[model samples]
Target: MQIIQSLSEISGRYRALFVDLWGCVHDGVHPFPGAVEALKAYRATGGKVVLVTNSPRPRDGVAEQIAGIGVPADAYDAIATSGDSARLAMYQGAVGTRVWHMGYADESDDGFFTPPAILDDPLAIERVPLERAEGIVCTGPADPYADPSEMRPQFLAAKTRGLKLLCANPDIVVDRGGRREWCAGAYAQLYTEMGGESLYFGKPHPPIYDLARRRLAAIADVGDASILAIGDGPQTDAAGAMGEDLDLLFISGGLGAEETGTAIGGSPDPARLERYLAETGVAPTYVIGTLR
Candidate 1:
């Protein structure tokens, strides 16, 4: 893989960029030093940027959180979140209206139960038990710091009832200021292993990419040839790019850094990165130590 110093090298080649949020833009706690500036600079050069994230929050909620986390309003044009995509699946009648949401009642906002503000639906959402609901929707664990193993029984029980799970975030884990935290994908993976069917609407899944593509198309007339997906996770970001036939720019400092034997926020190691890439078998079009 080619190790690029700056996104500008490939910046001119693409009219639009689908940038990942958590790892590439900011850690859960703070924005990366040069990440915001890089995106702002890209937009200033007439590039349309869409913040694509596997966050289970609705697009508006994600946007607000990012803004609070220090990413300026002008850094990107639009946001397409997995929560929004998952809700669309529900709206399209892919799953039943009544959902048994598996996430923290306190940590979650109304976005988890209601439609996005863009849709302006007047109906209020009500939560039900797994037996009463027609399907399961897991935004994440009930506790932010809870282990995926703690929720295994619940997932398996839902599976026994033939309930399909809608995984809003397909990220197995994410870095929360250098600490790895379990995400919805971790639970979904275990559920799948236990013969549970799941519908994922995030990175590495075509549905989320399709939502991102539509958001990008709304702002600019760009094709897949002129679009690049920038992210740090190989299984989620790079694999998703590959599935959507989009180019990938992988950052080797966040979620995947551990596999490369590189500590979080450390300089990139070309040798270890190469080995890690080979192990994962996901080839990115470009590689950067971080999203500068």
Candidate 2:
């Protein structure tokens, strides 16, 4: 038999929590109702919480953004970000190298100093060239790079030069506004499909989970079966929890934005909810409209 419980009851079972950052803790625009309160209460009761995110931003940068939006830095035990994983991949290589970042280039990469010859040019494979590149950092929307048939011309320029692809965000798709976007993952997937090697990090992968696990070990380590991971998106979050072997709680409004309309007294109608489920094929352990 299945049972439903409130936020407190859900979090009560685990001594340590590995929470997804954007959807579970706060919406992109603001903090979700009861998230902060529930977290503070959980920590006060000696439960450990760690904020795990795939924002492509460094952990410190993510922390600052969370602080700007009001999730206390102390509320969570540790942060592990995709950017940090990307940096780790680079660090695995020799220093003072040119790694063409073919994704969303954050201002942090350029501001404080020069780190790896970071470039955001999608066409750099032809113009600037990747032959001399120490490695290739892929995190770009490939559709804009051109149709799949045009892949060889764009990236073969890099491969012709023997460039390795380092995938920062291993997410195949991300919900942007309300649509599923083709990110760097699509490109990396294509590269490997064509027999090119790639290093993957972030959701639905093991590296990010191992990192989060090591961090969780210091503060707390609850059995995986007892830990619940609440998230909004299925492709990344729900699938990620399944990949990590943890329980899942799905939020309906964030990445599942298609159902935000036609409120049934202020929430998505059941028909719309069914539509989203049918469309995404995401089955969560718990389905909730909001944190409150």
Candidate 3:
């Protein structure tokens, strides 16, 4: 990995940037000082910023959370969320319409129950019993502070029903407010292990990237060579960038930080990170301690 101290060293190379939200930009509680400033600085240089996230909320809903967390609108040109892609799939009946939603009642999971956009073929997304449901839509755990084990029973039941799963957020875990928490991807993995088919619509998946590319194209005529993906998750961010054939700027923080002996929100140890990257076989175009 080419370890850099700040994004300014290479921000000018990209015309469009795909930035992650949860850990790279914010910790689900407050915006990172360096991350916020980095986005603002990148935008100041005429770079079109797209807030690409695995959040299980619509663009507007995610924007509301971003605003609430004090991330100014000037930091990003557009937002593309997993929820947006999931909703589009649901609307197109890619994954059946009638679904048994397995998620918290938070607004982030609202796309499963509410259709904010006009559907060409309107059909009620009725929440029925697990046995009667045609498919399962999993946004995340029902409790914000719960572990993946807490949802084992629900996932097993859904698996037994032979229902397919449509996971909005493919993030297994996230560092929310400096605390580690399980996400929808954890439960989806469990369901898949029990022989249930799952379709994920987030990082490491193509659908979410397709949606993000559209948002980026709307602002500027940029290609893969002119786009950079920045995030903290190796499996999600790095993997997604590679799959999309885009360059990546990996931040040494969040879930995979421990593998490289790097503390969350702390400076990275290059030697340790090199070993970790070699073992994982995941490479990035650049590596930074943080966004700044």
Candidate 4:
């Protein structure tokens, strides 16, 4: 697939843009080339852009991280993250309600633009006893899932509690420096397999996009179909766009290099690709190797 060459083509078609962070804009370490300019050009042509990500950080925290990495703060209008979404979902309850942060949250986790109870110590969650817990919000560091054996403890904990598991990042795993790393979703799947109930609040889950649209509506009265969702992962990004009935710019550049046997995601059979797309019940409006 060809890279999206210029912003002009994307200008008229999309009213507002919901762009993914992490793999699409940065590699967890640095920003991609021309990513900022791409958003600037999109906004220059009268489009409103919102950075939609599954990052476990809040909006301001996300903006700060992106800015530190070279993306211009003015390039996009705002951000919406799964962390904030999870927090929102958590406190839709009575005041002073107890919640177990079944995950890790740091100083950066504060000032989320929405505040909720945060318990950083995973052991506290394990030792605190489950009866006092109202709900379990799982978001923590997952690294080097080289062997499933390494992922055992935490996986077993959530399963043992079987409390309402809130998966902040919907992705099962992601690549870090060419090494595959797990995320909240891996345990989430295990939790489900072990008959533990859970709720995923990010990509491939339509409610996130729904929340994003409602947020965007404050700027412009746009419909869902007019919102373009862009991302690098075909499964999460493309599939999520499909779930929301939005157009997709399936970026082929990033982690998939191995899936394609040429670029991102590595080598995979064409039939498998077709099946992946078919299962979503929504198709991309365009496919590109990069956002350009």
Clashes of each: 0, 1, 0, 14
Q: What are the runs in model 4 whose C-alpha is more than 4 Å off?
A: 1-4, 93-108, 111-134, 142-161, 261-282
| Residue lDDT tens for model 1, 150-269 | 777777778888888888889988888878778888888888888989898898888888889899888888889999999988888999998888989988877777676655445567
lDDT of 4 by residue, 1-292 (tens): 2235444576588899999887777776667666777888888888889888887677777888888878888788878788777666655531114455544433334543254544332121222434556555667543335443454565466557656777777777776555677777776677677676778878878767776887798789888768888886666777888777788876655555445333432323445444544654436776555555
How should the candidates be ordered by lDDT, best one leading?
1, 3, 4, 2
Clash pairs detected, candidate 1:
none
Model with the higher lDDT, candidate 1 or 3: 1
lDDT of 2 at 65: 82
Better of 1 and 2 by TM-score: 1
User: Top lDDT: which candidate number?
Assistant: 1
Q: How many Å off is the CA of 248 in candidate 4? A: 0.8
Candidate 3 accuracy as lDDT: 0.82
Q: Model 3 over residues 79-171: C-alpha lDDT tens digits?
A: 988888887777666557677877875545544556746566656677777767788888887785776676668778777777788888899
Winner on TM-score between 2 and 3 is 3
Candidate 3's clash total is: 0
In candidate 3, stretches whose alpha carbon ends up further than 4 angstroms from where it belongs are 105-112, 116-118, 263-266
